[model samples]
Target: MPHSFALQRSSVHSTAFRRLAWGLLVASWACALVSIGLSLARWAAIGHAMDWGRWLPVTVVPAQAMVAGVVAPATMDTAWRWLGVALECIPGLALLYTVLCVHRICRAFLRGEVFGPEVVRGFRGVGWGFLAMFVASLVYQVGVSALLSWLASGQKAGMVVLGVSSFEMSVVVVGLMMLLLAHVLAEGSRLKAESDAFV
Candidate 1:
């Protein structure tokens, strides 16, 4: 009777957790969509205002000199700066995809199919998604920095900062961990099949 009660309790907990995860995912996905829409609108506005009729925002900054001989320009192409802003947001989109994978995993768990191949595959998807996000973020930062610097090459001092952030490194580590978990799940699923065959 105690074991039966414990099993029921655990089932209830899993169900509750699944429901909560679904709600949170829906809310987060809505927010992400809104954010992406707003970003696109802002970029469109900037692009329309460009001097070349290319539609981009413009900003003017005072000239600076890192050394006495090297002078910088007071103005640069700040128009397509919206592109950089948009690029920076790529990770958020990747995370949304990851959330979808997690949602699938949660569904499988709710159905008590936790050790199934589908669950393992979903875990693998999540791991790869995180890894992709990390790579995309790094590319965005470095690429944007380089592009901006090149645009300002004639006047403003070109600056490029290339380094992996701690947060990015952490995400990479998390991705690796997820992949490890997927491997464990694969083994578990294999063992489960073997045991079931005996039964």
Candidate 2:
């Protein structure tokens, strides 16, 4: 495991953790919407003789494929720019779905529905969503690189890189761990049901 996987009790109080989770859920949705809106706006800007020199700050949410500061190439055509935007939105959409799954899990926790079937399903959803996000990220990275390389074909200063990043690998591992945890939760729920039946 690339990360130190520990389920330590939150140093902050449980109430604080709950509050934070709720805040994160809201913020994640807001960011997802903003990312989509920004992509649409950028797509609209493609053919308007927009100034690519003045780099606009892109709002990047966590787990998104595109990090901040990747400026649009001046020589990039409208079609390629649109393609890049579409690819970049893949991770954003994935992250949004993942975050919503996490939010469902958190809501169950707040309701004291731990070890229930719903929570287990929520965990499974999160695990699958995380894996999907990672896969989409790989596609986004490769596609954007290819798009940029094509755009800069006539230029001597163009650069393109293709490699598996450690961050991406870590996310894959985390997804696996989440799936494992989901299995554990399912088993626990089953055992709890059996015990209740005996009582």
Top candidate by lDDT: 2
What local lDDT score does residue 132 receive in model 1, on the 0 to 100 scale? 87
Which portions of model 1 show Cα errors greater than 4 Å? Answer: 1-14, 27-93, 152-157
lDDT of 1 by residue, 1-199 (tens): 5697578558756757668756765775677677566644543443232355557545322111121122223343465565546664776678778877877887776666768899898889889988988887776556555545555575345565456767789989989999999999999999879977976
Q: After superposition, how far is residue 122 of candidate 2 from its true place, in Å?
A: 1.1
lDDT of each: 0.65, 0.68
What digit string (tens of lDDT, one per residue) describes model 2 on residues 1-199? 2132123233223677778767876786787788777756655554345444569634322222234323344454666667667876888778878878887887887665677988898889889888998888778766665555445455444444455778888889989999999999999999879976976
Q: Write down the RMSD of all candidates, one decimal each.
A: 7.5, 7.9
In model 2, state the lDDT of residue 26.
79
**How well does candidate 1 score on lDDT at residue 87?**
65
Candidate 2, superposed: residue stretches over 4 Å from native: 1-17, 27-72, 155-160
Candidate 1: C-alpha RMSD to true structure equals 7.5
Instruction: Give me the displacement of residue 79 in model 1, in angstroms.
Output: 9.2
Give the least accurate 10-residue stretch of model 1, judged by summed lDDT.
60-69
